[model samples]
Target: MARKYQRANRMNWLMPVLFALPLLCLAGAALLLWGDQLRDLINIAVKLAVIS
Candidate 1:
């Protein structure tokens, strides 16, 4: 019973992280296209903040 509860908790935590992974990849791709500059950093930060 305790193990099941722990697994449920872990799954709950994992789902959001898994979903966020794709968005992170997309953000990284956008950053690559933009080049590594202050603008790109700000854009990535904003994108991550909004998605989260």
Candidate 2:
């Protein structure tokens, strides 16, 4: 019973990570696809900050 509980506990923590992995992969792919736009936004933000 203790061993089964331990296994369940381990899976509880792991399940969310398993579910999030695909979402993380999609986010990474999106970043890669729009990296140039992200960089441009960062540059604009920096320029505005410096101006202020």
Candidate 3:
């Protein structure tokens, strides 16, 4: 019973981290692939801010 409880607790912690790791990787890949576009967006935003 204690072992099961401990395993359940471990799974509760592990599950979210396991799921989030892939999400983090996807975000990193997106940044690497689209960084130039993101940079352009930032520049446009800066220009708009300056104009305002």
Candidate that would win on TM-score: 3
Q: Candidate 2: give the clashing pairs.
A: none
Q: Which stretches of candidate 2 lie over 4 Å from their true place?
A: 1-14
lDDT of each: 0.85, 0.93, 0.92
* Tens digit per residue, CA lDDT, model 2, 1-52: 9999999888887888899999999999999999899999999999988965
On a 0 to 1 TM-score scale, where does candidate 3 land against the true structure?
A: 0.55
- Weakest 10 consecutive residues, lDDT, candidate 1? 31-40
Model 1, position 29, has a per-residue lDDT of 90
lDDT of 3 by residue, 9-29 (tens): 878878878989998999999
Candidate 1 residues 1-51, lDDT tens each?
A: 999999898788788889899999998898787766868789888998896
TM value for model 2: 0.53
Q: Which number leads on lDDT?
A: 2
